[model samples]
Target chain A: MKAVGLVAEYNPLHNGHLYHLKMAKQITKADVTVAVMSGNFTQRAEPTILDKWQRTKEALSVGVDLVVELPMQYAVQPAHLFASGALSLLDSLQIDDFVFGAEHPDWDFNSLVQAENKFESTDFSKYNATYATAFNNQLIEHTGISLTEPNDILAFGYTKAKLKSKLSVNLHPVKRVGSAYHDEKIDDTSSISSASAIRKAVKNGSAGFESLVPEQTAVDLKELKDVNDWNDLYPLLRYQLIQAPLNYLAQTYQMSEGLEHRLKQAAQRASDFDAFMRLAKSKRYTYSRIQRVCLYALLQISDEQMQIKNKQLYLRILGFNHLGQEYLHQIKKTVKIPIITKVDQKSRDGQLQLDYRAGKLYEQLSGVEQDMRRRPIIV
Target chain B: MKAVGLVAEYNPLHNGHLYHLKMAKQITKADVTVAVMSGNFTQRAEPTILDKWQRTKEALSVGVDLVVELPMQYAVQPAHLFASGALSLLDSLQIDDFVFGAEHPDWDFNSLVQAENKFESTDFSKYNATYATAFNNQLIEHTGISLTEPNDILAFGYTKAKLKSKLSVNLHPVKRVGSAYHDEKIDDTSSISSASAIRKAVKNGSAGFESLVPEQTAVDLKELKDVNDWNDLYPLLRYQLIQAPLNYLAQTYQMSEGLEHRLKQAAQRASDFDAFMRLAKSKRYTYSRIQRVCLYALLQISDEQMQIKNKQLYLRILGFNHLGQEYLHQIKKTVKIPIITKVDQKSRDGQLQLDYRAGKLYEQLSGVEQDMRRRPIIV
Candidate 1:
């Protein structure tokens, strides 16, 4: 039985995600579908509105065969790393196809990936500009098309990852449905909405978001007491930056070039997350990059530890259907890495420590146990 | 102008403290009154109900001529360390006498201190019992008098500190009035109440605590939006323990043995400060000692850094009246250490960093700035 793989955050598992999940199976004609979903936090370093469990239940309820966690070290990173991490996990699962949504699905991402290779490595070394801006400048110069939309950039990242890793899985980019990626409000006429739009509606207590989500997602959304976001996490982040020693903070993953001092000073002055972002944001670091660094600092994920964990990947199953169990049985002999269903003492402390810590941090907001003795959802 | 010294947490200065201040000046015949008070956190490692500045104002309002902050390195510590640190600062101020309240003021505290000196050092090495318990066992064996009351313990600590340092100042133990140290509710019969009782009354929104405190303290208490304590700080503490590496946690001041693992495990399972303390508490570690270690972890105060800072004592003046200014001027030439009237950038980032961080943590609860360019309160 061939399996189709998808990479997603499923922040709330909206109708758009359901559509994407449905398309993956219909187009690929696979017997099973596997999803590598981010756990607790998004790539932007924002806590998901729903935890990985709630999101997993939503995925299982929507007929996704298998759901596995994208470890925090990879999840809360840049597009290139996130795409690569997700693709590598899918490659481990031995999936036949990988499906994703892109703003311009027909764009030749392969050529774009190849175009980026020809640029001088020195182009990314400018201290006063973001790496994204630097990369886009060279991309627009070479290909006359700069990938700016979230999914388009991710598409380029996915294609680059597939080529660099020589993964045998096929890549399919379907056109994104509903509103644009940045749209904050839901369109009245559409039955689907962006995750951010759904989150905004849920946060504002606005009506009409229920129509844009699956039945389980709508129930979970209604049950949410508070929306998990950076605002709720700012206190812990600020405390970490203010209290952690400069030398210790300097050891955080991706922390470089006296950014520790910058973050520390910003934390000292800013009382809230928005103000902190404004103070920490500069030409060299994107807002998301700074936020991801903040998360790294908060979780105390050191550069050495993250690097070690990045190489030692695992498939932490969050949920599975009967077909997923059968697919797992078929792949069990061939799958080289550990596939964890229940978080045991040894694995929770070792290979899955980063994700466990990240989940614990999220537990502060959700008040739900994130790991430890929690069994995977079986449907 | 001779000065009399007092050690206080103030937390929120009450009528009892005002009486103690009056007694210091009256009994010692000192022209100036000086106080060395805990800053944002108390000796029990709990955030004070009021920030240091507010408490300083209350001190100065009731004629505490001068108020200096007890640095965080010394403020949140065991009785011996807290006493020694406070006494060293008062000694630097060149005061003629030191006054404090005692549950048994007539008890032979000097002999108690001498008895403690006679104890075998190995008596404290028992891993199955707390240092205080072991010390008390030896004390009970030597003098047949076990210091169980909080004030009595502090009196013994002060006597030991004075004897050990050979401080020239006279030690006066005045009889403690009104409520007991452990009393949680305000007693109607007495106008004086324990800081704990006043805090409880304020927390419960029970009336009559206003009459037990000074006018300024009453106003500060009334204006308080929330009571700052361990319950409010548990999240940050839990986050630190859960996220920080065991090696880093082991470096926490007074975090010896395998307490790091115990704290980490407790933080993982316990949802609140009380529960965490219960889980962490054992015969080997007192609740107060565990709480102090938790504070050290939350503040990320390394034992090495704390040792260095403890030796580098500074007189950080929090508030002063005209007489206080005169007293400071009189002692300016004779004082060996820096007498800080304002928190400069150098001090905030260097000598005062621990207190600054503690203040920042307290600021999260109070929404009031603790340090950084803040001038001492002048009356």
Candidate 2:
């Protein structure tokens, strides 16, 4: 079977997402299309507008045959670790092809991958700047392209992770359509809008988002959590920060270079997440960077645990159609990791345990309870 | 120079509280009435309906000469520990007379105190029930009084702790008036209403509670936080339970004899706090018992920390009138512990640190901000 895999948040499964899904299937002439969807927390280090289960239903409503959760370990990080998680998840399923949206029309995937390798091998102490800053500089020096647009950078990370994983999957890039990556206003001149713009419109209770997203995404958005914005999580995050002092945060992943002290001080003074961001932000950390760190602190994800989950840890089926079910049955014997469908499966796998904990956390904060006994969405 | 001390939660400074204060002053003929108030968390092991400062203002407005916070180490516990903290706080100030409401109107206080000493000395191995049950059984044996009224048990604990502290403070009791301790309805015949009933009426937005609380409490209720029932705190508590395993909860101050396992299991299956309580409760563990355990789990108060804070820790002056200032000045040379009017007092005191952390936790859960730098209330 020729299976094509795609990595996505599908936060709301907009028209853009549906278009990418259809193109992936058509371009590869694949028998089955698999999507590794971001779970409650996404690659942006924030909760997905809609949770994994809701987005799974939307992905199935589209032409996709299967949806799997991108374990929170990988989904709630910067691009590199996130890509490694997605590639390992798809690679575990023996996917033969991979498709994604790219902003740059023409790019040298090999050169970008080489740049990533160099950046990792080189010692970071020589540069006073963050790893991202130094890596972007290397990209500029090698590819002569900024490569900073959301999908473009992700595509680079994806290519590098795939190379390292030694996967045989063929990479296909579809030119991104619609407003630019950072555009956050729905119906802003273009008929097709970015997921962010749609999310913003929905959060603001604007009617414009209805026309922007597909029928399934639109309906799901109404039934799912209002918006998993940082503001919605302020209370939990604030409490977490207050409980975990500098010494406690120092043990967490992504807390280094004296960031713990800054975070601890900010937590004491800041009234909310936004205020904490403002109080903590300096030249060294960006808003998104601090956000991701605070979230890691909130979940108490330690550095040692992050290393364990650097690659794909397990397969979790969110939803599967008939074709997807048959494909899973065929690959079950060869799949590299344990597959979990119920909450009771005690694998002792750190990633899976953390995923379960994250599910409970998300449920508490968002007031959306998903029964552990729930079966995968089948359509 | 005579000073009468009172231990109180004064959760909202209701009419009942005011009546007790007046009776205490008149009966003792005291020049100063010092109240050792429960801070953010009360003896019931729950957040106070109003933050300490607002309650302090109301307390000062209604004849309380001084308002000192009962360190949380003593407040969020069962009757014994709660009374230990309250008594220590009052004793440190050299209070001459102590006054409290007693349900057993005709019982001799000295006889009850002697019975308490006997209960402590007698071996408890014969009884299979909790220490409380055994003590109460012994008390009935000695005094022929079945003393289980909410205030009656606390009064016993308070008297016992006062005896141990050896403070020269004389004990006085005023008859409790109005509704029963557990009453949850307003206007149940008597003019004086229970604090619980008044809190319930205000929480339910019933307008009939005005006659039940003092004028200052009525006015301050509007400016204070909305009611902080367990439902408002479920997310934080659930997060704490999920993060800490049974072994971790075993280390907490209140967790004992496998209650941690029951709490952790219920936290997963139960939807809210009430559900968790129902799921975890049994003959051995009542609702209040489970509440204190969950509260200690939420605060992550360790057994070691509790042991370190078994007595007088610090005196945090929430507010004081002119007479209170004069009393403190007169006793300043002999005050037993550090007196604090600012949040930054560095008391190498674990109880003080816990009090500060509890304040922050209460602020986060109740959406009330008490600035660490704010001056103490004075009238």
Candidate 3:
């Protein structure tokens, strides 16, 4: 049983994503495709606009054979950790090939794979210095090309993890199409747009985004009225900023020394949350990073908690089709953790309950009380 | 002469800047205003968009009575160095006060000054983490607020320098108006717009920037076509990236240890300068910091050079009115360094030649041809 793997959010599988799914089947000629996707949160350190289950169903309706949850621990992490978690899941299932998108589609992957395999472990003592020395060295030796954008960095992360895992899985990269990543401008050249561009258009109420996504995804977006958005989190963030001890703030993820004092000062002067963030921004810390740190502080994610929860854990099931059922049967004995298909009351551990509560909050924020019905396992 | 001192670039005095000049004089009730402007480069580590002479002439046309050139050593230094240089110039002229903009219009200058004065003796060793730690403690003790934004940090620098110099000059802060600093948005509420926004608009060919700047500055900008921009320096930066020793690169300004190796690897993989920078960026080091470091490396500014140039230096004159002349004469005997209004051709040394050469580059880049018959300095 030849099996291929994908790592994505699906968030609402668009036509462009479907095209990749079809092309993966045609090119790899694989019997099954398993998608290891984010559960509730996204890579941007924000809650997904849609629930994971809805996104899973969308993927299933498209061409995806099976959908497995990429546990929350890895989902919200930086690119490398996210990739490692997804790749580990696929490796455990004994998948043969992994596919992704790249700006330069014609670039050879075999050379990259070979380079990844042959990378040396040098002293990264200066790792905390001015730049990321070890990561760059590996990238240069592997691709013979530099990582330029966020997407490129992510691709490099995937490659690095593949190398570190010592897995023999083949790497496939498809050509990125249409709008450039973070390019808010709509293009008529191709019927594809980056998720960033789509999100921007949605937020700004800009025109020409509908044609870029699948019809069902658009419908889902339209029907989805309320969810936990940035604004909803602002008040909570503000309260946290006011109440959090300066020392405790320094312990949260991404909260460096001295930044806490600055944050504390800005909180007093700012009339609201946005004003506070604006005042807190500095040359070294980007606005996105500050926002993430603020969120983490609000959530009270301590240094010790972060240390323990940073690793990949159980593989939760979201959705699956007929082909997915067969693939699951083949790999059922080899899997490490429980592949949860239903919200089992018996399996609701402390952490799992917290995850479920987060999901419930997400549903309430998104204005979808009716969709809270427990989903049945297709398999 | 009761004069107010300004440390500025003028760089084509826009309307909002003109408003600042007018307001400073009106509020401070000063007879004259002197501006210590940059010779060629700016504090942000970029060359001025227009030549210094052109910028000086524009400043003179507005409310400025005198314009002095901030020596290159001071002009291109970091916030503390830049502030110290500007303060030294004002001190030499015996200016009574120094006025500037602050995000929190309500910032208390006396308290700030007191905090800065007390900081040196304070037990800052208890928070011996980074520069930010000691600075924040001072701010908290002074105003019970945390220091957050770049401008606030700069204000702190200015206050610290003023207190350390023991200059009897008062600190005054005006509330910034219109769009937020570095905000790309165009708001017509107030004429004030950040220099970053104006530069961005100019680069993108957007209109409505004229209203944001003074009329004279806009005319100067129109006259100065084909100015040397960052694009022209890309080749030089690329060469530096390629040839710079990994160890030396590590010592370049913000180039942390491990970052040098990352940069070295990136240089090898990147086909161009921009690609190299992108590859080198990470969560730890921002793109701006990287760009500044690259520029520092290109200029061969070592840690040793930085240490020597970190202190304040003498001032050079650009242009001045009658009142400014009176103000200069009053403190002529007490001034620390030679008030160089005219170039000393016979005494031109290596440093002077270097300064002159940088100025000449600015002239050439501004697309203005110099008349061979004209003297190097304009009276």
User: Considering every candidate listed, which one attains the maximal lDDT?
Assistant: 1
Error (Å) of candidate 1 at residue B98 is: 1.7
Chain A TM-score values, per prediction: 0.98, 0.93, 0.84
lDDT, candidate 3, B1-379, per-residue tens: 7988887776545665776787789789998898888877777667787767777777877768888877766676667777777777778777888888677757765476666656655343455444555667767876688876666656766887877877798878776556666677766676777776777667676787788877776776555445556665554444345433356466675566466777756654454556777888765555555666665665445575556654435556677767667777787888877666555543233334335534433443353422212232223
**Model 3 Cα displacement at B75 (Å)?**
56
Q: What lDDT tens digits, residue by residue, belong to model 1 across residues A330-369?
A: 9999999998888877987899999999989999888888
Model 3 spans > 4 angstroms off: A105-144, A226-228, A271-274, A344-354, A367-373, A376-379, B1-379
**For residues B1-379, what per-residue lDDT tens digits would candidate 2 score against the true structure?**
8999998888878888878998998988999999999888887788888889888998998889999888878887888778777777788889988888878756775678787666655453455466666667878888887768878878777777877777677878778888877888776566688888888888888787777777888887755547887887887887877764456578888687787877877888777878878889876665787888777777677887678766447788889999999998999999878888876645412446677778878878666566477678879
Candidate 1 residues lying further than 4 Å off, grouped into runs, are A125-127, B124-127
Ranking of predictions according to lDDT: 1, 2, 3
i-RMSD per candidate, Å:
0.6, 1.9, 24.1
Whole-model Cα lDDT of every candidate shown, in order:
0.90, 0.79, 0.66
Estimate, for each residue in A1-379, the C-alpha lDDT of model 2 and write its tens digit: 7899999988778888878888998899999999998888866677788777878988888778888888888888787777777888898988999999999747877677776555444466677666677777877776676666878878888888878877788888889998876788775566689888888888887787777777888887776546767887777777776764456578888888888877777777788777888889887666677888877877777887777766447888899999999888889899879887765545432447777777777887677655366668999
- Models sorted by DockQ, best on top: 1, 2, 3
TM-score for all models, in order of appearance: 0.97, 0.92, 0.46
